[model samples]
Target: MAHIASLSQLQTPPWASVDGQLVPYDGVRIHISAEALTRALSVFEGVKGYWDPASETFSLRTPREHYERLLRSAKLFHIPVDFDYPEFLRRLEQLAAELLVRERDLWFRPTLYVTEGHWGEGTRATLVITAFTQQKESGEPMRLGVSTWRRGTDVDLPTRVKSSANYVVARLARIEARRLGYDDAILLNREGRVAEATGACVVALLDDEVVVPPSSEGALDSLTVRILERICHRDGLRLVRRPIDRTELLAAQEVAIAGTISELTLVSEIDGFTFPVDGVLARLRASYLQVMRGTEHLEGVEMVATDAGRALVTS
Candidate 1:
């Protein structure tokens, strides 16, 4: 894809493939049964890799775990991917390095889909890996709003899997919210509880406690959420997962959302209520910076830091 000046610069990664074979980023052919393709029978995971100025190397936040989650999504959606874990990781690493440019951030995506087979009403199974980059957002606080749309429940669709079909609703919600003059939308669960932002997990501070909707509320299991939980624990903040009412947004002292694309960002306002940009959200953002930059690691997470004259090596 050509880099449009107004948008982020994105390039095809050399390591990306389709159906266990290397292909151009966009060349990956997705073979889905007509029924499944029309009904959105696909599972995908969006991940981000960071390029450290100090290390001058690109590092995936949690490549293996991310793929594991993707695998789980595939299983949940009845999709199949015929590739070993080690080879998958190796390919991803190769792609990340080859795809990196002068951009400050790189966005990576790996998708598992169903090939042409119709078992009942769904799809057969296949897998593809696609990756690209997005320009880093200048540090700016977002003004959010409560979305009128509710997240699709497991009863409605397989909420546990990160399926492409699941995002259609979210995409529309976000588009409508932006038309309403908000940066994003916070989806409520079927029970009208605050669940998550369309593409990100929502986190807010209530009574000095970190509150996020439990997975039971229909939020996607976000890798970014795990990172935030770790940061909260390290900072001595009490992390609580429970249902949050819409009114709680008013009570939230600090509000933020996390995702691979956005990472950690502060919400400056919701529904006209102004919020302080400097608060727990800011602190967490700073801590995340430290962790990703190789200054610190959250015990088990890996940081890709490179030494002088060292480049990421793959077999």
Candidate 2:
């Protein structure tokens, strides 16, 4: 996923847990020719943790889903890591407690990076858990734009996996959008259908339902979008999964970007086409925040606190 901390004044801790070792951030290093750097032999998951002052805890949103997706990405790219799911969670809890202070939201980037070798040979993956605090406002809904470049298909780059190399395409598109004075870019698939916006999913409201482009159309399986899907089903909101045309989005009543970092940023316009700030997106955003930020109790969230006496002691 694209960095959600991009819009925030993020604070990084002094230390990072590198392959189960707590190493200082400045001490962390990899060779310039490492496979991860040269060939992008890595996959990562961005886990957001909401800090609840009343409870004195950091509630992690859908960690299991994100973990499964991370494993799938590693499997797809053959990025072998030494740690299993149990060990992974242990490291995350240990790291977050060490890095994050009380009363602050946390973000973790658990990345499996190959530090040596090349072209599917002589490679070993290391788990690097990078932590940050969402210390600033994310600002207003992004002023979005559409890139002229077409996104790669599953047959080539495989959007089903959140591989590091896949983002090179997004980086290019993002540069183009920034130059044109737009905050972010939405890339179309090879067939001119809406795939996703950079690292976020493209969600549009039409009539009574919200439309999301399927993974078959080059959209990555998004964790945030999946949560929103369940919210819609539970709340009786109609959410459709299909290919979305650019014009279809333009003509829709509302548009927004959904992902781990962007959360539910409502779109102001796209390629000069304006979208209204409607109730549908607002409701979805509100429900999502209520669930994610611990205001509303929901199933499948992992809460961790610095001290056992602080709050809901899920860890």
Candidate 3:
């Protein structure tokens, strides 16, 4: 692995939170109440920022929705925090202007935490924000292998909230799969239905429609998934929400995964079974790229690449 220069190595930018509050990039830390730490009472969100060199402007897509989800997660987890959405967005933009110099991609993570105090209880909630430069855009398709490990049952842990505790199951599954020469893992729900990949939502193209595991599949309700769904409906593609079995994946004409970080990625192969790159997945990939870049607008029925053999929209 190669090392990119850390933010500490760069000149600090003029950044602030929504409330015109400045956070120390040098020594910022979150203090969690003892009870919150012991019980894992915290919520977080992940967002991506793009730096456009041509315009010298840093832009984030749907930042407010990300914050809203964060707040929703906090409420879900019973973690109380002093939250202000509008101010938060302003602070992120200010931070991007101050800290980020190059037009590279970046990932922003903001966490609301409860710090422990005396008597095994929490004192106050704190916020920790960190930004890192991303060297690669997540446009390339990934190879996937279905994991033997089942995703954690929602009964065991809340799967709806973006909490630190939920990632333990994901970490173990993804790490073990990577050890087996897989790019990623697809976790199965309790009933052997498709769940999702590590840190991403999964959708498969089947029967000439876009099929995603229903919310009951124990998958996170992803904002990206919602956006893609809108695109699908507009394209007149049949969008089905149901339990997708392993065989469905094998039978899938094309496979794509969605997320805030990963965006729309074509799954070139699954479980060592290579699907043709020039297929329906390829078309979805092309259309998805156009929509995200704000290049093409979908007006009812539109043409999309189904495989790699078809032409792609390139930079």
Please name the candidate that would achieve the greatest TM-score relative to the true structure: 2
Q: Supply the TM-score for candidate 2.
A: 0.91
lDDT of 2 by residue, 1-315 (tens): 134335224454788889988998778887888888888788998888777767666666677787899989988898776777778877777777676666567778888888876788877888888887774244367778889978898889999889888899998888899899888899999899999988799999998698899999889998888888888888899988999888888888899999887788888889898877657898898888888777776555554444422433444
Q: Compose the digit string of candidate 3's lDDT tens values, residues 1-315.
A: 012113424534334232245666654544443444776766778777655444444566567788888888877666665758767776666555555545465667777766644442455656666666665454666788888878767677767888877877787787877798777789898788898887788888888778887667878888777777777777677777888998888788888787766777777888877766667657766776566544566543222211111111121
Give the runs in model 1 whose Cα sits over 4 Å from its true position: 1-15, 31-36, 120-124, 136-138, 304-315
Best by lDDT: 2
Candidate 1 pairs with clashing backbones: none
Candidate 1 lDDT, 1-315, residue by residue in tens? 111111223344555655556676556554443544666777777766776656555666777778898889877766666777777776666665555665356666676656566663444565666667665554577877788888877878766788888888788778878899888888888888887888788888889898888788888888887888888888898888888888887678889888777678788888888778787779888888778656786887755432211344232
lDDT, candidates in the order shown: 0.72, 0.80, 0.67
**In model 3, which runs have C-alpha deviations exceeding 4 angstroms?**
1-21, 24-26, 31-36, 117-123, 136-138, 297-315
Better of 2 and 3 by lDDT: 2
Lowest summed lDDT window (length 10), candidate 2: 1-10
Q: What is the lDDT of residue 31 in candidate 1?
A: 41
TM-scores across all candidates? Answer: 0.88, 0.91, 0.81
Ranking by TM-score: 2, 1, 3
